[model samples]
Target: MQSVAKIRLADALVKIMEKEGIKYIFGHPGEQILPVYQALRKSSIKHVLMRHEQSAAHAADGYARASLQPSVCIASGGPGALNMTMGVATAYKDSVPLLIITGDVSSNLKGENVFQNIDVNAVFKPITLQSHLIDDPDQGIEIIKKTFQSLKTGKTGPIHLNIPRDILQKEINPSLLDESVEINIKTHWKDINQVKRLLRKSEKPLLLVGAGVLWSHAAGDVKSFAEQHQIPVATTYPARGVIRENHPLSLGLLGTRGTQRANYAGKNSDLILAIGCRLSERTQKGLGNAPIIQVNLDKTVLKGNINIQADVKEFMEKISPTSTKNTEKWLHELQSYNKVHKIRTNYDKTPLKPQMAIKEILDGIGSSILVNDAGSHTTWITLLMEVSEPSSLIFSGGFGPMGYGIPAAIGVSLARPDKNVVVVVGDGGFQMTSQEMATICELGLPIMICLINNQSLGIIRQWQELYYGGAFQVKLENPDFVKLATAYHLKAKMVDSPSEVLAAVENGLKLNKPLLIEIKVDKNEDIPLPK
Candidate 1:
């Protein structure tokens, strides 16, 4: 008979993380999570100490999006856990897979209203796919395995695990750590002949992809399928780089912030094939009343004329190419919209135009992974920047969270040390999580922080200007960002002229360390909306 060795629950959990190949845990330490931290100290996993609990979650979210693997974030109970709600919600909305662990009060203190004790699981239930409370010591390892299983299967998103502090110190069988769970994801395919018949009959067709393509690693397959069928492809914001925006058949982004050509294509297409994306209101804004073929792993989002619930990659591989009519003329007509509605990027103004500044920065950064925050600048970049590589551009698209760029850049930098990371943030969003500069400097990450300083909440101000009578609380009296970056021990520069914008960006990227370039732009500048 083999004897089972005893192991601490926290230690076993750390071992499970190791078994699952988690490299880092982005979090802020607290008393409740001390045991896991202690176990982590002796383990192979590196703990990235974030300045705030929310930033930790954002960092983990960024890491998962960039690496296409499940990432981990840890926080203490109550306030610590509550602060991560926005980040958790952001990940949930975007379908990013993350393992979120929160340390809770002792099991005996339930309902006693102990310090830092709120039902973490209940609070996170709505935001997470699965929120679990590990009350039984015997179920600790099993719960963790289940969490990983949940992260890998179905429509992947963040999963929450609340472990009581006492349970962390409890003993468990070491043999349980060696146990493994195999996830057999069943693939469901629809009738290929019916889909091909739709393709054959349609003269003007558009392929709209979303984040699911990236999550399923179906970029190559999607690109090949589009080319094989001579179809124009447009992607949602999160799925920007899936098909390489520079391709001739690419219609770029499709939505409110999307290109005019892409929107026109969507509004006039005879048939629409939407894959791996929810046709949200924003994505469906300028779309036409075409018969839609929607493919997604989640059956809930399968609301289309013809719905197929299957893995994106498997579906793409199985669907054989068929002949289409008038695609060449359709492609040419769609491409003509680009010339008719071109956004000018050249502006030689005193305080730089946002479009010009954004163009300069994006042009200067060569093949670097771009992570952007929510602002009017997001519109400018989405319009001007071109993405050639899949999963290279990361955005908080669905949740549209402010203060996401800096911390997300940290995660991206950690995940891909060989590639430089650039964070394009507005003055308003930068201030929300500016404290993360210390983390950047401490880690010596190669990140170029492009701060578009319009000195106001640009997007909100635009909305107020358009809808409301005028701007009210949208203006800002900002600090000297150059001095702020310097104080954080990062290389800093300020550029107000259009000619110096590209130079500043080039110099910052060459520094090969944490650098911030503050580009002053016209506060009154507005994002050009599709007419």
Candidate 2:
């Protein structure tokens, strides 16, 4: 009888990951995960060692956003797994597809209260779409297979898998990992005829695109459809670049912090064709009682006058409106409104205005990917920056985590080495994951860190000033960021005036190396919201 080929469970797991086309795994190493780490040494998959497990998850999240492919992150048991909760939750909230793996104690030690033993699945179950533990080495391959299959189907989000330490060393049949599962996704097409009828009857119809459009890789189709039928386009914050913001029909972002014209269009349109948008409270606040036709793969988010549970790209492709009502008058009115209510960024003040700083950064970056952390800086960028391509502008929109810029930029840089990456972060958010500077330097990525130092949690301070009558506990005594960046062997500079803003950014980008430019702006400067 012919003997079947045997392989270590850890080796088989790594081989499975390789077969799944996972190029990188962002993570930190631990004693419990050493066997898998050993297996990775022989595989073609590159492991990026993040400064913290949270950063690893965040990095993987950014990679998925940039690459438009499922990304992976790993952590050890107990504390390591716990640290990944926030990042994983952020991915979940944004619907980014990420596969998170964690190493746990041996199966025999379960229920004995051993060292570094905690219920990882329980901790992660609420945050991830699926959380499973692989106790049986023989079933490990099947579990991983199901995990990847789940990640690729339905509404994309994070999935967690915990493998016991002892199980990693056991032997398994290597042949079991060879065959790939054929996932047949059943695409739904229910309300297309109604949607087409609505479009034909409506005069001032608007297309409200969201992150779902980008995730489905339907931006081109969405844009083409908008152009084919004379419809204007507006995107949610995370979907800023779905259609080039400079397009005449593009209404930019649509929400409280969005462009005035977009908000106005959302409120005034006769019919709204919302594609892949969750229509969150912020987005819905601007959109008036205009009847909406929402199309999304996740039926749970389908709350509209007419809801269709279908893939956004597929829907866009199939719903071909043969003829539509001429909207030239409405388009002209929107164009006029866009000109009159343009967000201004031409402040040449002594201490830089955040708006002006954002404008300069956008101009200096010039088509590179711009990733912003959660803070008042996010508001500034959303207001002034215009992205020209899908996935070029990234944000922690849903969970709104601080300290996501640097690590996420690391992931974007690694995912697209051909394009330079810029991080626009506030001083408060920068301190949260600044240690990743070492990782950037080690990798020698050409990422520019634009630290907007307002010396406080700018957004919270703004809230307090507007709503609570004062700022308290929001102020921060910041460190010398220039010296700190220098300590990490990054090219560093400080600019406090508008005259120096563009020059500094241009200089940093010209260097084509890891750089940090700390822009000292007015701490009391509030984000300019539409009146």
Candidate 3:
């Protein structure tokens, strides 16, 4: 008979993380989570100590978005755990997979008004796919397995495992746990005959994709299907990179900040094939009553006129090529809209128009991972920036949270060392998580952040100007960002004119260390919206 080795529950937890192929754990250590921190020190898995618990979850969210794999984050109970809710809710809304382990007060202290103790399981229930409270040490590993299983199957989202301090410190037998369970989610492959029939009958067909396509690794499939049938494609915010923006058949993004051609194409199409997208109001508003052939792994979201419940990749794999009705005139009409509604990105303003600066920067960096923080700048970047590859642009789409760009850029830089990472953030949003510059400097990550300094909460101020009287508290007083970056041991520069934009970007790209290039723009300038 084989003998089972005894180990601390915290140590056993690390073993499971290792088995799951997790490379790094991003979080902060606390009094309650000391055991896991102690175990992490002796294990090979690297732990990134974040300054704020919220940024830890954002970093993990970024890793999952970039890698298309679930990432783990840890938080101490009470305030620490509560701070992580926004990140978890953001992931859930966007269908990003994450496993968050929170450490609570000791089991004996439950219901005794102990420090760092709350009904965590109840608080996280609405935001997670599954929330498990491990009350017994013997069943802790089992709960971990079940959490991962839930993450692997069905529509991917965040999951939480609450471990009391005593349970994390208790001893457990390692050999008794199962280590070889399947991790891939099973798919119910649907027939594509009806889809083919719809394709043949339609005169103008358009395809809309979202983050689900990126999560399932179906970018190539999406591209192939579009090209094979000569159908035009557009994507939501999170799916910006799934279809290369430079493709001739691409309509760019569609939403409030979308291009005019994309919106026109989506509104006029006779038949719509929405794949892996939830078609939220942001993507579906004002879209005419067109018959939609929706394909998704989650049946709840497959309520289109023609619904197909299947994996997007598998559906594309099994699809048979067939002749379709002519769409050349429709394509030409969309192309004409592009010319009539072209956005002015070549302004020669002295204080440099934000769009012109973005254009110059894009010209300098051909194709790289772009991260955008939530603000007026997000609208400009998503509408103007060209994506040349899939999974190359990360956005806080569902939650639209500020302070996501800097930390997310760090995570992407760490995950893809071979590629360059660029961040575009407004002055207001940049200040929210600028402290992550310390983390970037500590890790020596190669990322270039283009801070758009408008010196106000640009978007909210715009809202105030249009609706209600002009509100105060919108203007901001910021530090000298260049000096701040220099203080953090990073190369920095400030651009005040259009002529200086490209050169600054070129210089930032040459450095092997972190860089922050601040572009000063007019605070009163508004992001151009589609007419």
Candidate 4:
């Protein structure tokens, strides 16, 4: 740890981050951050330059998700900070670790009509773990350290920091620097006995995994607990693949656009171990009847939609001893469901059985990161894919924003080059951030792109067909994603029939480079899910 003497605030900022082990900074620089930028240039931290401030935030979010660490993004005042909000909110909703560092107007000019100024703290408060502004030069290190410490404590999310232009450039006076507190404080889970009791008494238990498991790198623990007790795992959109989808214990996603298996598992379960996730309506289908054994870091989140409560890690650590294991009676039932589903899939003749396609991929890939963009594709992909490891599946669950998956996957790839990044995106959704193909190509990140090309905004079209008499305007023929990939100089392939699923899965991941496999599924196909 660098000793903080009364020094330049930017100097203190760099030293504090270095001590916190922050190696990479993602953002675009502006006049407000010039002092910090100059200091950063002299530091070992590598800054990734992005085309847009929002992209920078997404990149930072990606770094955090992929690396499983608090990733940082720096932006200028006003517009830069606002743009950064997109990714900040994404991190907030997804429960990803991110530090959003924004340059603010000078303290004196903050409430005045200064150029490029913003109320960064006020704007980012809701989306952050903590919102702080660096006012005095001497308070820099303590503030930085405290911010990171606060973020790591409970239900960690995005943390925002506003560094004023003038203060960052100011010299700190000696005797004011103090680093007395530890920054790695984490809380204990709530209702340990209650959660364990629920798990123990559950006749049919459902283990719901979210991005928090990934954030905590607790997939191994979750998998062990689920498998040991034969509990079925249901994934949130952002938490797909945390349990290997085909794992007898894994039931894929539940809710409005989920699989029959997932829906049944959740609905029928007597106990729902909603670990590290706030059971949202999209995952719960408005039925919060099952007793939810909620174990999370934040006690405040205990007031969930269901009767769930507590910090998961704390509960598990204390309750694992009290909890009995070696129960596999229910595994037989899950296996029976899997077999029946498979046999029925072979017999069914739908235009495109999304479940079948998903089953194929889940069966084929043992370990890979799956990113699902918003719209109908998000639901379809969730219904199909399974992740055995935490952080393997990524999504914009809260925003449900279209065109978020592809770029996020790109970010994930940058963060986890060792792991394979596979994006399951629809034609319309893919069109939103398809420009990321160039980023993938330039970065040389190997990711498999499963472009479900139905030639329409399938989700809205599904709604329109159901309610609007099939009047389609914006949901018409889509531009060729294959051509788009080709234009980006990335590998491209087309799959028109079910016969192509296996081969595409094989070659797409085999390319060992970025590739787009466009699957033109039947438009009439439906994702059987909870209402």
Candidate 5:
């Protein structure tokens, strides 16, 4: 610690965050967090105040997914922190790098009948990669460093740090940062013999890639291996744009709504080389109930169809992309499968399907950054949207959180100011965090947000229709997003017919400010997940 003019402890907290390169945070101010608010007012860290804590948490999750960078969120104690727990869990499960900062009852007041005091650490422990209480103000720097290191370690996820009201005002020395040593993380390696035997022996091989591919920016390496060996590729929803959809070996997406070619190959492959993906039902076809060689950083993934637990990068690095090998038989067969059904863009002719509009956005945007919120709207987007680059598609595959798309688009735009960022969110999910439009407006960060106004939580409706004989409740009704967008002083256009979509999206993108394009999607559109 060094001496300086007396500064508010809260200001010091914000300063530490700013020094770590956090551009913005999504949060809701509350009484327990009043001191944080007071300090934030004077600090350089910009916060997006949301209507609910969950939305803020999801937005942070979204931000992390979009930029491959850590995103932050703050909430009041008790119900406020409780409200954000699921979203935090979503990020943790999905392996998103997020920092969730929650306010708590004064440290001195804990267990003394204090208002807004809850065991946030206990509740967050199961979800977060790490959870800590800032018991000593002087230890703030150390806690933050370790928190970030833990959250950013291989196969990163969310971490939680609770700052009590009284603790936020304690001043501490900055010298701790000098004494902190950054540690290197070694990606776990696999048995060379096992991996070598699998690659050398397999005749029918298929490569399934996911968001982890882009997270590590190994699309080039994966592509190199595939091209060298002529391995056909099938992507999961979260990994839609990891490689060009039209590439000779790329099968776009795999699952119910995925291309028929991809699914057929999954069913036939003797060796399913799944990398950076958990092989979710939509992608794995329930693990194909077959032999699968899954490569992921998480050891828990081994419980499923996974045969090995080595980091994808580590394994790929060890195995030379065998120019000596050929997968011609497998590639030819899968291509034949791709040719079987002749995948069609039927939504173009269908009556106002949300997927049709999604196609239009993809068609017009080419390869711009895309963020898909969790829900049915995501289903339509993932199945229909086309992208040309790796890491271009960002979605909550494991940490499925609604209201994540829009705020994450803000982060995308901030991270890559030159590129256009688009967010696709369902009406039910949109309204949950639509208040963030204020944040978008305040920053004047241009982003095009498409709200699929289906008037219901489409995914839950689909689930009810499937297993519960359509016993849908608490999934109905949606607010007018145009009105909500107007209140936030952001430009918004409502599209009810197919004819109005392209022009509205174009106008929205052209605007120099935040814009929302709301499409009156059919509530009856029972879209299914892509295979």
Candidate 6:
């Protein structure tokens, strides 16, 4: 290595981050991370001081989801790191790529009950693709580079780096850092002829796009493949915007709160070309016997009837969609089913239904990115919202976190400043991270929050009504949301009836500022899942 000027390890790490185009680092300051804070302050990377460490992680997640790039979040030792576990687990389950950095006790204090010290590496093992404790300051840049490279290689998820305070404060030679290391990923192709033969053989074929398409940036290729083959496409929650939901051959979302049309199409398909998706429980139902051609970046995820372990984009690119077979009859059958399974969204009710409110919101907002929190409202959006482009809709998936929408929307707004960013949340979930409204005010970013003020945990209450004989503890009393927004110096309104929803949403969108529209929905108005 060439001899170069020496700098503090923390500064060297921040320098490498700047080299990699990391514009921001979401985190909280602490005693152990003081060096990191000082280094970041001097460098070009701006650190967002979050209200809580959990929000820091979620912000990183939302940023990565919208930007399609790996994001970084930092936290202090022990309690701070523990606080980040929920957000880390949320990203792990959803397969979002995030780099989590946590401060730790000094190397000399290992296992000595040091203040704010815990087994950070062991705690994050289950939730991260890789977890390491930096014992030597010299290895910091290499480790950071390796972590970043690993996330971009194949199956993407969260990774943890626990840097001891002593190590971060140690001096390191700048020339020792490998700043030019590039991510080299290659997909080993299997036999494509057999997959092609199967595609040609099938009468009714359905292309199931998953989160992998978003990771691989293959939405365009997937769209072209579907259009050329004239195949109906169904998506998982993370893959909602793989294609325009308004496309003629689109089947919207599949599984959980999936559209009746999408579910029906999946059930009837003779062959399923599942690309970049893990055919998990949310997207897979009653398709056990169907011949599945599963394509994924991770080979382990391809455990279907027929599996292809290659880069999703490369695999999709090689597949010829120019099928000579005339499958108009099969396409017609799925399209007919789609028409028959159309959901009713124009109900005129006093205390507005969730579906009706969602319909108006979708109709009112034109081509804007939608972010949703996990709750009964998520089901409504998955079923009702028609998303067309990738990165258009982001939500907590496998983890189903309650407080994700508000902060994640803030992150999304930061990433997608050119597009209008909207968030939908239930009253129960909104309060969990409603404090982020303050974050929005501080940043001065215009975000529209559609709060479904249903006076209970709607999903839990519905389950209790159905199974637990109308059990209790689900009812909630909310502070006047309009007042809540006003306290934060934000524009807010409350809509009481379905008739008033569109006008309220229209007015909020027209404001072009931080606006919250709290729709007072009936507690008893529950949408049972489609049969």
In the range 247-329, model 4's lDDT, one tens digit per residue, is 76677766766666677677666677777877675776823477776666655565443443434554445555555443466
Residue 425, candidate 6: C-alpha displacement in angstroms:
1.0
What is candidate 6's lDDT per residue for 316-358, written digit by digit as tens? 7788554635678987887677554466777776777788888
Please give the clash total of every predicted structure, in order.
Answer: 0, 0, 0, 12, 12, 1
Which scores better on lDDT, 1 or 5? 1
Least well predicted 10-residue stretch by lDDT in candidate 4: 339-348
Query: How many times do residue backbones clash in model 3?
Result: 0
Clashing pairs in 2: none
* Candidate achieving higher lDDT, 3 or 5: 3
For residues 300-400, write the lDDT of model 2, one tens digit per residue: 78899999888888788777645789999999999888544466778766777888888888888887899999888887677667789989998889899
**Candidate 3 residues 395-434, lDDT tens each?**
8888888888887787777778888899998888888889
lDDT of each: 0.88, 0.88, 0.83, 0.72, 0.74, 0.84
lDDT of 5 by residue, 1-531 (tens): 956555545776677677778887888888777877887787677777766787787768666766777889999899999999877887877777888888888898887776777788999999987789887876776777777666555567788889888888776655554556474554444455666677788887778887777666677888888887778888887777676888998887877567777777777777777888876756656235456777777666654343556566666776655433567777777777655433244354435777677766666654568888878767666556666776578776775667778766766676677777888888777776677787788888888888887778777877787888875574655666788789988888787766567777766666656788888866787775433
TM match of model 1 to true structure: 0.95
lDDT of 1 at 320: 46
Regions more than 4 Å wrong, model 2: 180-187, 339-344, 347-349, 529-531
lDDT of 1 by residue, 191-220 (tens): 656887898899999999999988888889
Which regions of candidate 3 deviate over 4 angstroms?
179-193, 321-333, 336-340, 347-349
Residue 426 in model 1: shift from native, Å?
1.0
How does model 4 fare in lDDT? Answer: 0.72
